[model samples]
Target: MIYLQLFLSYLQIGAFSFGGGYAAMPLIQAQVVEKYHWLSMTEFSDLVTIAEMTPGPIAINSATFVGTQVAGLSGALIATLGCILPSCIIVTLLAKIYIQYRNVKIMQDILGTLRPVVVSMIAVAGLGILSSVFFLSGKFAPALSNFNIRGIIFFAGALLCLRKTKLSPILIMVGCGILELLYQTIF
Candidate 1:
């Protein structure tokens, strides 16, 4: 029964999540954290972080992690399948329609409109992550006293690297990970 619920929940996420992994963050957060209470917001944020660092789509990674945490190996498999099932079906269907109407203005228009929405979704996901990491309350509304200085420093450094240097994102992440490890050890 829990497996079925997980499947259905991810199926809905996969179906509605149009612009890929980052776009699905809010939906995943809503379902897993807010709706189901399977994970706290902090846990969900940590899951997202782990998912991002792993070698697969964020949605699938998140499903696997959350499912495993909740119901073990079988749950991981079921949740992953559920998360990807809708994407597989939708892509197949879209491919057929897209091939036939590759030149259609309406289709192009739809895609154009989705670009901004996708950007917005990604932005929301970014803010969610920031809130989780920087706010001691692990929520959007952070009191001044609750601000995480280390997190802020990390964020600023990452942004600086992104803006001023052409360093690979992987390198930046690895660097940050090492720095964080050192910080944890020393302080």
Candidate 2:
């Protein structure tokens, strides 16, 4: 029964999570955190971090993580299968249709329209993570007292590095971790 539930939940995530992993964050959060209570918001945030740092898509990694937590290795396999199945089917079909209609106005228009929606979804996911990192309460509502100054400073510095330097993201992440560890040790 638990396996069935995991499969179905991930199936829904895979089916509707358009525009890739970043866009799927909200749906994954809804199922894993809000619906199943498998993980807390902080855990979900950590999961997102882990997922991003590792290989493969965020949805698949999240499904595997949640499934493993819920039901171990077998659960991870089932959840991963469920998460990829819809994408497999949809992409195959879409590929065929796109190859046939690559130049059609309607197809172009549809793709154009989807861009903003995907961007908005990604932005929402980013903001959610930012709120979780920056605020004590982890809610959208802001409070000056709850602000995490170190986190904001690190974020700003990272943003600046990305915008102004040639440093790799992985290097930036490593640097931030090292800085945080040193700060914790010294302060």
Provide backbone clash counts, one per model. Answer: 0, 0
Worst lDDT window (10 residues) for model 1? 135-144
Pairs with steric clashes in candidate 2? none
lDDT (10s digit) by residue, model 1, range 1-187: 9999899989998899878899999999999998889999888878987998889999999999988988999999999999999889999999999999989999999999999999999899888888878877876554688887788899999989988999998889899999999999999
lDDT of each: 0.90, 0.92
Give a tens-digit lDDT track for model 2, residues 1-187.
Answer: 9999899999999999899999999889889889989899999999998998899999999999989999999999999999999999999999999999999999999999999998998898899899988876787556688887788899999999999999999999989989999999999
TM-score for all predictions? Answer: 0.93, 0.93
Error of 2 at 46 (Å): 0.7
